[model samples]
Target: MRQSGTVGFWRWRRNPLKRRSDVVEAWVLLIVAVLMLCGLPLAGVLAGLHVDDELQHQREERQRTTAVLAEDARAWQAGRYARYQATVRWKASDGTEHTAVADVGPESRAGSTTSIWTDGKGELTGEPPTEAQAASAAALAGVLTMGGAGALVLGAHWVVRLSLDRHRAVALDQEWARVGPQWGTRHA
Candidate 1:
């Protein structure tokens, strides 16, 4: 009984070669493992990007550009449109005094305040992701979802095939036993 138990336990252990039900099962498992491995990182990356998008959307929806009453636009150089800078004061959600060098197209008037939001660089800016970035992120999410779903399907298929193989093997052995005596004339 101990010997039989040992044999059974070893058989039950995970073995790559012993687990294969057929060519199909092997192929399925291989495809699933590869796709899942690749999809894990992609899913993480997409999830991070999704969080960034959500944060940006929230910021855009909640923030408003109120005119700064106590601030003025100060140009650092003449004849240089892009090099112009200004100290603009803005109030945040927590009522913190956020000050930044505001740069709009050309230069802002001394008393005018354009809409802006705080970005990851700790700079209040007025730009968002272009259409190309959104399209690329959407494409990446779709690809990851498809790959993960494919992996899950293949894994399920391999598991079912293995179970069916075991069932059929037992049934075949029993059928052989039932008919063995009719053709049995052993020379030993």
Candidate 2:
């Protein structure tokens, strides 16, 4: 009693049986499609760019300095990794000496020198990420942003569809109740 391809756009086409809820659902679908296809990707790109800029600024504020071990470092093995912690002394740009415990290689001796990173105030800090690492982080942030936004959009769309379906069901029940007695009399 129905055509195959006609079912695709029935909500958009003119039909006596189509309810106002159907038109609302169609518009919701159109808006969701536009957001998923365009808005989400643009948001992801902006997030990536912001992350990359922040990381680059931090990298510029760090510097590497040579540190000499103040005490002998005994290597300790943890699973397949081995490292030693020893007190190290390093001079800042202002000729002030600073000492801190730092991780060193297993073969390091008391007088051996190793490289360490420092902040603008000559405080020891972690090494700055390389260009490739920063890029990877930015890409990961972009992907996560896109995935999160997509999920939220899909969740909202699902909620709207469910509400519309409920509305249609209620309307159908009301119509059937009004028309049921006539059908019963005709059958009798």
Candidate 3:
């Protein structure tokens, strides 16, 4: 009789990874993972660009407002409590120079430049815009947007991968079934 051990070894070598279909499935899953890793951050950034509060801050730069340095301790304290009058010079997008009185924070220093925004009621109010706020808002928006986009991308990719893997598994099972009788006989 032929050596069963040698025959079994030959059969195993014929399919190293179990099936060629397995290789395909692995590739599909890998692509999905990569896409998920990339997409979430992109979505986050897109969303952040449209944030209303941050946009308002940016637009206020064009509005005119009054700016005053916090003078004495009392004035500073009062300025902190009640929105004090501040004079600010702001340029419109059209390049027109304008000045207006607006409410500002006491943290505003003498000669420190700030943008003033006017309310719909023609009353100007708000803290003197600081580089810190602008920078902070921008950073926050960026981080959030990126994070969201990353999540979205990851989710989508995972879903796609899962579907592909399921299909692959089904196909692999069918193929195995078809080959099963032949392989089983050989083994026996």
Q: Give lDDT tens digits, candidate 3, residues 73-160.
A: 1232344356555555554445556566555555665567655554433344454346666556766877877766666656765686
Please provide, for model 2 over 1-188, each residue's C-alpha lDDT reduced to its tens digit, 9 standing for 90 to 100.
88888888889889998889989999999999999999999989999999999889879988999999998887655657767888899998888999998888877889999999988889888998899999999999999999999999999999999999999999889999998878766443
lDDT of 1 by residue, 1-188 (tens): 45665663454456675533445455655666776677656675666577557645745554345535234555566674535566677776566677767654344666776666665443465656555665566566766766667667667866777787887798779989999888988897
Relative to the true structure, candidate 1 reaches a TM of 0.41
Q: Which stretches of candidate 2 lie above 4 Å from their native place?
A: 1-10, 91-98, 185-188
Worst 10 residues of 3 by lDDT: 68-77
Candidate 2, residue 73: lDDT: 84
- Every candidate's lDDT: 0.62, 0.91, 0.57
- Candidate 2 clashing pairs, residues 3+ apart or interchain: none
Candidate 1 stretches with Cα past 4 Å from truth are 1-59, 62-90, 98-116, 119-128, 186-188
User: How does each model score on TM-score?
Assistant: 0.41, 0.81, 0.43
Measured with C-alpha atoms, the lDDT of residue 143 in candidate 1 is: 66
Candidate 2 versus the native: TM-score? 0.81
Give residue 145's error in model 1 in angstroms. Answer: 0.4
